[model samples]
Target: MQTWLVQHQKLLSQQLAQGRLAHAILLAGVAGAGKLSLANWLVQVVLCRQVQKNNDQGILSPCNSCKACRLYHQGSYPDFLSVTSDSKNIGVDDIRRISAFVETTAHLGKNKIVLLPMAEKMTTAAANALLKTLEEPGLSCVLILVSDDLDMLLPTITSRCRLYDIRPLSGQALLESLNRGQTQENLFANVSQLPELTDEQVHEQFRQFTARLLDFIIKRQNRGALLALLNENTYAFRWLEYMLVTMARSQYNWLSWSALRVKLVTAEGKSAATGAAPGDAIGQLPDSETIWQIYQLVVGCIKQLKSMVQVNAAYLSEKLLVDIETRLDK
Candidate 1:
C-alpha cells in the first residue's frame, strides 16, 4: 500500500473494528489517486474469512490463507461482483444485474461485495435503479462506488452513501511513497530542474504553461512556445487536453477549481477565481462552441499518441496548435 492509503486504511479499519462500516461507500477522487485500490483493499478486509491478530498493534488483520481470501485473490470469488462498462454509459440493465446479484445469498457466508468503478458513467435510468438497491441493501451486502468526477453523479445516489474524499500526495511524499519498493527513474523532469517538486509547484507550472499556450492561440501568434513544451515531454498532450477543458469551463463560468484540482494562475501571478470569465485580451475568448471543437481536436491528438502505430509528436502538436489557433481566429 502507498503511504497515502495507509492513513485511509487505518481509519477504515478502525471503523470496521467498531462495527460502524456503512453498507454503501462512495470513494471520490481524481484519476490516479488510488480510490479503486483502496476500495479493493476494503473489500478484501471484509471478505477475508479468518482474522489474524497483529502482534505489534493487537489489531485484527485479514488472513490471506483462508479460502475466501484465496478465491478473491484468484479473481473467482462468487460473492464478489465487479461492475464496469465498456460502452460510453452504463445502462439500466447493468444496475438490474447488480440488483439480482445482491439479492442472492453470499456463497462464503461472509459479506457480499459489489464494486462499481466509474460510477458517474451510469445513465439517469441506471442511477435511479441503483438507488433502490442502495436504499434496501441487505445486512450482508457492501456496495463500493468509485468516481473521478463526483459532480457528474446524481445527488440522490451520493446522498445515501458514506462519502470518502481521497486526495493526492505532494512531490516529496509521493516520490518517497512510490519509491519504497522500487528504483527511481526520471519523474519530475518535465515540471522542474529539481529532483522533486511539490504538488503546488507542479500545478503552478501547469497553469503557467497553459496560460501561455492560450495566449498564443488567442493572439494567433506562433506556436513555437507550445511546441517547445510539447517537445520536452510526451505527457504535454494530456496537459493540453486538461488546459482546453479548463478554458472551456472558464469561458462558460462553470469552472470547478476544487473538483478539477487545478488553480488557474494568470500571467500576472494572480490566482484567478473559478467563476470569473477569462480576460478579453484577444477581443473575447472563443465561444463555447468553438472551444468544444478545439477541445475535441486536442482529445483526438491525445488518442493518437496511444495508438499502436507510431505518431509524429512534433507534427501532431503543430497541427493541433495551428488548428486551435485557426478556430479562435474565426
Candidate 2:
C-alpha cells in the first residue's frame, strides 16, 4: 500500500474502533489510486476478530490465518457482499437485491458489509432505491461505495455517505513503484527481438502507443510537450486514437470531482444569500469546460473512425490540439 493510503486506513480504522464510523463511505479517487485496495483492507479490518483486541492497530494487517479472515479471503463470508455494474449502469434490480441482503441478519453475527464498485454508474432509479436503504440501514450494516464519478450519484446519496477523497500518487512515486528495470534499454527500441513486422504492423503498434500516451497526458498535464507532437503529420492517426483513449480515461476520473464541484457551487449559492460573493464558493479549480471540450472532440473523432468516414486523421488531430491549446491559454 502507498503511504497516503496507509494514513487513511489508520484514520478510518480508528473511527471504526470508536463506533463513530459512518454507515456509508464513499472512496473517491482516480482509477489507479488503489481505492479498491483500501476498500478491501477495510473489509478485513471490519471483519477481523483480532482487530478488536488490538485497539484497531494490529501487526500491520489482519491476522490472515484467522477463521474470519480465511472465510473472507475465500469469498464465503455470508455477511459480506459486493455489487458491480453491468453495461454502463447498475440497474435498480441490483440495488434491490443488495438492499434485501442487508436487511437480513449476519450469519456470523458480524457486521454485514456491502461493497459497491463504480457506485456512480447506478441509474437514477437504482440510486433512489438504494437511498431508502441508506436512509434506514440495518443494525451493524455498513456500505462502502467506490466511484471515479461522484456526479452521477444522487445528491441524497452523497449526503448520506461520508466521503473521503483519495489523491493520486505523484508521478515520480508511481514510476518508482513500477520500477520496470534499472537497465538503460528502452522497452520499445528493441525491434529485432520482436517478431518481424510489416509497414501496416508498425502503424498499428504506433497507434496503440499513441493512444496510451494521449490518455496519460490528458489526465495529468494541462499544456506541455503534446502540443509539439500534434503539429506533425507523421503518426497522426495513432495520436488521435491515443487522445481518444485519454479522453475516455479523463471522463472516468471526472465523476467524483464533478459531483464535489457541484456541491461546492450549491453551497456557494447559499453563502451568496448571506451577502457573501458566490465566486468564493468555487475557488480556483481547473476549467471543467475545457475538460469536456477535449472529451467531446476525441469522442467525435472516435465516432468518425468507427463509421470509416472520409476524414483526414492529421487534420482532426491538429484541430483538437488547437482546441486544447486555446483552453489552456486561459
The backbone clash count of each candidate, in order, is 0, 6
Local accuracy of candidate 2 as per-residue lDDT tens digits, 155-191: 8898989998987544444335445333211222132
Native-to-model Cα distance after best TM-score fit, residue 148 in candidate 1, in Å: 0.5
Clashing pairs in 1: none
Every model's TM-score: 0.60, 0.57
Worst 10 residues of 1 by lDDT: 184-193
Question: What's the true lDDT of residue 63 in model 1?
Answer: 91
Model 1 bad stretches (over 4 Å):
53-61, 137-139, 171-238, 241-325, 328-330
The lDDT per prediction is 0.71, 0.62
**Model 1, range 1-330, lDDT digits (tens) per residue?**
655666777778888778898889999976657788799888888888776656554435679988988988899989999999976678899999999999888888778899999998888889999999888834578899999778878999999999998877655555565553232212232222222233455445555566566557555554787688876753466677766776678776785433232234344534332223443223345678998999899888877754423357778888888788777777
Ten contiguous residues minimizing lDDT sum, candidate 2? 189-198
Pick by lDDT: which candidate is best? 1
